[model samples]
Target: MYISFLFSSFYMKTEYVVLQILVLLYDQDVLTEDAILAWAREKEGADESDKVLLQQSESFIQWLQEAEEDEEEEEE
Candidate 1:
């Protein structure tokens, strides 16, 4: 039980780190959405939960893009 708990905690923390990296890449425009998706899909031990998190990250990127566009338009 202790081992399982430790593994679960480690997995959750790793997932959080992965999500943060994705967001950072998005913010930097270092990777396109397709590239990000491909990279996530290629990650070891990726599962449905990871897919869900990726979706959330994509949505966030989309939101940020739209917000930036809106600001640019407002300034024009």
Candidate 2:
């Protein structure tokens, strides 16, 4: 599966490490909020950029959920 994903997208310079993570999360249905937070905590030490990225990710998740809820309201 990983090899197939690699072959489909040759343009992006995706590291195997990142791709492996995507695969693990997607294939195993492991992308829970708790898991994501734990992973971020383990990897993103006290670096300022990491801090910013974590904040942005959180904001994006919140925005996406809100957007989905709005869409559901419109459909109803």
Candidate 3:
């Protein structure tokens, strides 16, 4: 997964390796949902692309939460 931020005429790219590391951290419970959401919100700006990303992130987070609840119910 490639995540990039555009500022002015320049584009900043986040490396795939860094994303993989973040995934690992999340899997280990080192990164909480609130933390991820906060980070995403903080990065959001007036750019259209940024707004799209924020919306996607919110959707993804909701999906994750619902999946977790389903799993817990199944275990019960």
Best by lDDT: 1
Task: Give the clash total for candidate 3.
Answer: 0
TM-score for each prediction?
Answer: 0.48, 0.29, 0.42
Once fitted onto the true fold, the runs of candidate 3 whose alpha carbons sit more than 4 angstroms away are: 1-14, 46-76
Best by TM-score: 1
Task: In angstroms, give how far residue 6 of model 2 lies from its true place.
Answer: 15
RMSD values, in order shown:
6.1, 9.3, 7.6
Q: Given candidate 1, what's the lDDT at residue 30?
A: 91
TM-score of 3: 0.42
Instruction: Candidate 1: list runs displaced more than 4 Å.
Output: 37-76
Winner of 1 and 2 under TM-score: 1
Residue pairs with colliding backbones in model 3 are: none
Please write out the lDDT profile of model 2 over residues 50-75, one tens digit for every residue: 56445545544454457667888999
Which 10-residue window of candidate 1 scores lowest in summed lDDT? 36-45
**Candidate 2 — which pairs collide?**
none
Q: How many residue pairs clash in each candidate?
A: 0, 0, 0
